[model samples]
Target chain A: MTIKEKSEAIVEEFAIFDDWMDKYAHLIELGKELPIIDEKYKDESHLISGCQSRVWLHADYVNDNVVYTADSDAVITKGIISLLIRVMSDANPSEIYSSDFTFIDDIGLSTHLSPTRANGLVSMVKQMKLYAKALYLRAEK
Target chain B: MGFKINSIRNDFPVLSTKVNGKQLVYLDNGATTHKPMQVIDRISNYYMTENSNVHRASYNLSHIATDLFENSRKFIANFINAASYREIIFTKGTTESVNLVASGFSDIITEGDEIIITVMEHHSNFVPWQQLCKKNKATLRFLSVLKDGTIDLSELLAMINSKTKLISITHISNVLGTINPVKKISEIAHNNGVPVFVDGAQAIAHANVDVSEIDCDFYCFSGHKAYGPMGIGVLYGKEEWLNRLSPYQYGGEMISSVNFKSTTFNELPYKFEAGTPNVAGALGLERSLRYIQDIGLDNIFKYEDDLLQYATKKFENIKGVMIIGNAKSKIPVISLNIEGLHPYDIGILLDQMGIAIRTGNHCAQPLMEALELPGTLRVSMALYNTKEEIDLFADALMKAIDMLT
Candidate 1:
């Protein structure tokens, strides 16, 4: 599915749960299903700073598309990162740079996030886009 | 509970707040405390009528302000049983209090000198000494805590030698809730001819603190933690030490006289206070101290101890709940984690259920490293908290755990 289609699908899935508990349960399930990043990529270099929890994210370009894998010591953070990875991963670099990424707000994730977690989410999105831009520039070179 | 806790809790207006359609169960006392109505009213009264710049102003308002401000220091000095009111120097908070001492002691702390602190100190207590030692070419040594979170007293005594110039330690571990034997520690430091600075930020409100009884050279604590207003803290130094140590900051109100060639500083207390102080905060702090005194420290300690025991038993029985900081002597603070469950997840879930708890390293990253934990969910209680709140917290935590695991 396209990045927008994937975000819409996730939003629709979240809409099924009326209770915060059930939504978190769904998030936890997503966390458990998150594709584990390689042990080598779990180093400090790939770690995102300023998060209350530790999140290690790694991205690589394949056929001009960015493939991202990430992990967090925190289950909720892991679940949240999975959303970003699913939406932006395997998308064209230009598409990632141009995408509005309104699914976070549509799913009411931003409003529910604590200030610290909100910052972490922003950093994750920023990192994903930076990876795409770098790969696009390298492809040009 | 010996005291009328329900009535006492009513004095705190924030206790009646509802979060997410549930009664607010505030358990983040270690971060800061909710002020009583008396304190809030006192602050308002100061701003409304007694509002004026303290000292240097020849007016009725300034006189009233100065009287209230100075009386606040005197009241706090008496509250802590300091040697004299002159020994009490006000600062922004505990951080600034420690920084003042660390900066003032720089002249005496020379190259090859040593400073000793514990592994469980909050960053406020740890960072200043660490940076001072680094800048002064001194070695900063840490007394390791045991697995159960209590500091190794014998080990700390052994570490002190002629090379040790100063010893600064926390009276209570913010994360561990371990109450260190400051009096005993002070005795050892004095025997070694070393001055001791006690960070009483966590201890002052929960228990009675007497600088005279402890015999520590210096004691510092924040007013907010003791149900006072923020931006005001107390630093009690021995008269001799206060006289010998140079002022950390130089500005108005701290100088006796100013000249282009050389400036002479003011006397004790004023020498340390370099600017227009937080007069209203000081007044509010006095009112807070009065409120706590009315409740009585012994009574407060007894009530909180009972609450801790009950909560500890409840949490101990919960499956998958691992209670960290199992110190034999502790206050109501309890840090815990569930097997395979992140602290942030538990904290957020509990907040949704109308309970407030602190998560993460709590500004004690080195302590977290030593304990080998990413972080913990800490439920710290104050005098106002009751057993009912603990039950609600446990119920919410269990539900969160069930949902996650």
Candidate 2:
């Protein structure tokens, strides 16, 4: 499925929970299932600074698609990163770059997020797209 | 010393607010405080009844506004025990208050002079001096925090020498909640012939601040921290210092007369206040100070002291709950990091459970770096907060830890 479709799927799933408590529970569940990043990639070089929570993101280029791995010390931050990964992992670099993260707004996650968390979310998205852009440039070369 | 908790809670309307289907347990008083209905009503009343430009017109409305504005200055002067109301200059907040001093001191600080501040100072208190020192080609010396988060007073005294121009320090640290000995340090600074500036942003609200008692040359505090309005802060300087230093800003309200070639500035407080003052904010802050006076700071101090001890004991029983600041003398703010768990995660989960706590550096990056902590979860208390709320916060924190692990 396309990244947009996968994002839509997330929005649809989120729409099922009316209460914030239930929605957070859903997020916690998602956080629990986030794939563990390799120990080697969890170094300071891959770390995303300026986040209240410590988040590490690492990318690998497989064939023509860019794959991403990330982890955060915080559960909600981990859930947020996992959501982005679910939508954009194994996707083309151009597709990742063009993505606007409207899915977060559509799922009402942006509004629900605390100001600090929202900032962290923005940084996470930027880092992911940056990785994609780097890979895209390498592929073009 | 009778202090009623329930009625005190009732004064703050936001205390009754429910978040995520649970009663809000706000423990983030260090960031800012919840305004009482008295302060809110005073602000509304000022706009509704006395909305006039102060010190501009001889009209009745303007007269009333000017009276209210000057009365606030007097109230704050009396509150902090300044020698005179003329010594109190109104600024935006503590940050601006510190900036005003830093700007005024810039001319006096020559090359190779030193400005000393503690590592635990808020960025507002730290950054201005840093910039001022850099601009003046002076050195900025930082007093290190002890293991218990208190400043080493002996070490601080040893560092002070002939080159030291000014010594600025926080009365109470925002992150660690360590209450520094201002009076003692002021004496030491005076002995060294250096002026002292006390950043009372965290200290003013939690306890009584008497400039006379402390004998500090400069003491500054924000109104919002003391359950008052934002955009109105009090900067109390000794009349001697106020007369000597130049005005920080030049504008309408600050000038006595202006000409094509030369303009003479207004005297004392007026010289410092630049533009048309925040009359509404000043009145609201006056009422807020009156509110605190009505409740009494000593009573508030005693009540919060008991609450802090209770909360500390409760957290002590929790596994892996490592508190960063265990100062011998401190306020109610508790900054902690749980083992194998991040503060951000705890803050998020606590927030979800209708508990409000500040998580991160709390703007004291130097102190955080010194302590080797990425960040911390800070739970600061106010007079309105109760033991029951702390119980709820502790319970929610335990539940959050369970979920995260």
Candidate 3:
């Protein structure tokens, strides 16, 4: 899917507004819909720190393309994790390197999070994309 | 389990207010307590009527402010049953207080020394010592908590060695509500020739704390957690240890004689105080303490005890609501996850009903890992909390769980 399509999907996923509770339920539903990663991608190295939730995320290089898979114990976190995997998972190493996550602003995301939580979410995204970038660099060499 | 519920509810403004057009039920006291009417008035009065810098000024306003500030220290010292007023040092909150000790006590941590902590400490207590040990080439040791959430005393006793420098334990586990026997732990640490620093952030609000009874080298707590204003807290250090540990910060008011040649520090308390402190915040804390004392700590404790027992029974009756940290000696807080429901979702749904609860790890990441579960919904209790609030929480939680399932 195109980046615009993926971004729109995320916004649609979070569009529920009955309350923060329903909002989170929808997020967990989004996580439930996350496409599975290949079994080989599950390993020890991809876990994110600073989250009480255990999230293992991995990206792979196939035919000069990157695909991502992630899993989390907490459904709400998993939904965000799914959104993250969709946003930064696939595409070229160069795109991964140069792209900014500025689209999150349009979705009115991060506003609900405290400063620390928002920063932690940023760190999680950064760490994931950096991992994908590493794989891309290795293949190019 | 009932004790003048309606009148007590009115004392806390948050309880009287409506959220999303619904009555507010606050069950997040472990995070922080909602201030009472008197405490609120005291804080407002300070800003409106008595706004002045404290100490070292020879003016009337300064003298009054200084008296208020010092009186606050005496109030808190008396609240905790400390021997003297000089024992209390104010900081931003419990986090800063713990960091102060970790940073200051680094002056004595010889190479190859160790710091003993428990697995259940909030990151505030854990990370500071981890950083300190790492910086000083010392080993950081964690005494483990059992499945029931209580620490194994024998195991911790084994961990203490000649190299063990300090035992820093949380008096009450924020996430689990597990109350550690600090007096016993302090005894063991003292036996091993190591001092103990008790983090009383969660305990001070719920239980009576006598620093002399605990007999530890250092103790720390926050005023916010005890129905007071935020951004101010207390650090109680033994006089000998306070005299021995170097000051963490350097600034005005902390110095005695500074000449062109060199700078000399002031005496105890002021030596660590460093700067002109939060005068109003300190007084507000003093008021909060008096409020607690007036309600009678024993009376409040008994009331909360009834509420927690009622809550536990009420929660257990709800299908698929599983409580965590079933330690025999626990405070009122309860962490539980509904079968197949996320804690955040539950917290959100409940918030819409004008009920406030905490979700996420509650800042005990390591304990979450050990539990092998995601974050749980934490229903923490305060002395002012009633069984009615717990009923509302149970009703909302069940409703949320049903929606999720």
Better of 2 and 3 by DockQ: 2
Candidate 2 chain B, run of 10 with poorest lDDT? B340-349
Tens digits of lDDT, candidate 3, B303-399:
8888889999999999988989898778899999778776765665676677888888899989888887678899999877777778888888877
Least well predicted 10-residue stretch by lDDT in candidate 1 chain A: A109-118
Top-scoring candidate (lDDT): 1
A26-82: candidate 2 lDDT, tens digit per residue = 787788799989999999999997677889999999999999998887787888888
Global Cα RMSD, each model: 1.4, 1.8, 3.8
Candidate 3: give the TM-score of chain A: 0.79
User: What is the RMSD of candidate 2?
Assistant: 1.8
**What lDDT tens digits, residue by residue, belong to model 2 across residues B200-224?**
9998889769999999999999989
For model 3, the stretches where C-alpha displacement exceeds 4 angstroms are A1-30, A44-70, A77-141, B1-3, B339-342
For candidate 1, give the DockQ. 0.73
Sum up the clashes in candidate 1: 0
Chain A TM-score from candidate 2: 0.96
Alpha-carbon lDDT of model 2: 0.90
**Structural similarity to truth (TM-score) of each candidate:** 0.98, 0.96, 0.86
Chain A TM per prediction: 0.96, 0.96, 0.79
* Model 3 score (lDDT): 0.82
What TM-score, to 2 decimals, does candidate 1 have? Answer: 0.98
